[model samples]
Target: MLKKQKVSLVVLTLLLLLNIVGILNSTQYLLKILFSYFVLIIAITFLPFLRQKINYSYKLQEILFGLPMILPIFLFKLKTISFAIGKLKHFEIFLIYLLFLAVVLLLLHHKDYRMKSSSPFIKLSISKKEVFLTILGMVYSIFTEEMYFRFFILSELEDYSYYLKIVFLVFSSFLFVGAHYLNKWAASMFTYKNYISQFILSMLSGNIFLVTNSLFYSLILHIAYNFPEIWLILKRLKYQQLHYENDGAFFDDY
Candidate 1:
């Protein structure tokens, strides 16, 4: 990037960060999305590569491919796994499956982030069924975000100088971390200590897209890296829900 471009990029990166942080207190999901898109619109106007009309035909094709996954989310909402399990034995089968998932998640997050809570930003007193639903919802979000960042955001910087792309890479990584702060679990999830892993994971997803030019590869990585944090969030919700239930089953190992 030219010296002036570098300076301007710094200013825009800060503006974008501020825009993201502005949604920190917002609880309405749809409105936060609108505000972020508004910022992106303003950003593209100043960004030379983005000043031209963007070809969203690619986005349309992606949505088509994503439909197979989208259908299951709706099915889960209609009739969840928790709804089918009746006996303790059945629940054990479910729990065993989740344990396998937990093993994969542990490989992703390591064990250090299991710190005791500093109180949540907002508590969700949710149930087993709700936990599955929330995770299904996160699956949808992972798809949306991978499309937005690895696909759309990176496309905006195509052919830009390598240094500028790296800057945007870091900026995009922070955007992922900023998203956690926007969550109800923010108080614990967005602590600066976790930023290192989050950045590495974000960069890994971003760089993989650049290498393969395929959202499919990057999307899977995003899900793999994020599943552990999602598990932690679900566990915390369960932990908080226990406060309201006299007979809540406790899983001591999480």
Candidate 2:
């Protein structure tokens, strides 16, 4: 393996091992700092010093510029973002997102459907602005992940036999899905739909990369897969906020 490939593989493998230990012991302390972790990944992965002179098709060489998105987390407590929900198409698109979420939920975890219940903790746990930032952060992380698991890994193995490349891709995709299991910070996040989404993404991302040789399409797929979880998050938060305003209760359900 090349020096860079060795570094990438070791780093990802160490993370997987850490998550495995976390799963066994139920330690998610790292989960709280995941935003910072993603920031670091985006920075180091694209940094010229840590990587070789490999040109990328996606042109993400300057990803450090996006680190400023974290400023909202530390500097501001923005209550509202306009979210610009006043438009007609915005509602239409939101409805589409809801429809998609419903279909997936029914198909995957229909037996244990408990979405009707509101989460009181969520009202105080996160805010609308944070959720919006999370959505953007999610997008950036998706791109970063696909770039690592698809483009960089596969590219490093390009000199190997085609069959060997397939094997590595399959293994890498497995690691990718397994990482999602480590990201199970909430019950809603680890639903059957979420697991299935990860599995499908693990397979499809590799196939897409193999066929198209670009992370752009796989990045889109990853984001699309997370839509259900994202919707549920927003739903609970919106519910809590409305109740908070109308009832003036301390930490009531959303």
lDDT of 1 by residue, 62-177 (tens): 34334433343343232221212244554454344345544644664454444423346226565565565567666776886675555555544556788977877876777666
Worst 10-residue lDDT window for candidate 1 reads 76-85
Off by over 4 Å in 1: 1-109, 112-128, 182-185, 229-254
Best by TM-score: 2
- Report the lDDT tens digits of candidate 2 across residue range 57-169: 22354344344333423333422221123445534544554455446656776554444334444445456655665676667767656655565445445456788767777
lDDT of 1 at 136: 67
C-alpha RMSD values across all candidates = 16.1, 15.3
Show pairs that collide, candidate 1.
none
What is the RMSD, in Å, between candidate 2 and the native fold over all Cα?
15.3
Q: Assess the local accuracy of residue 170 in candidate 2 as a C-alpha lDDT between 0 and 100.
A: 79
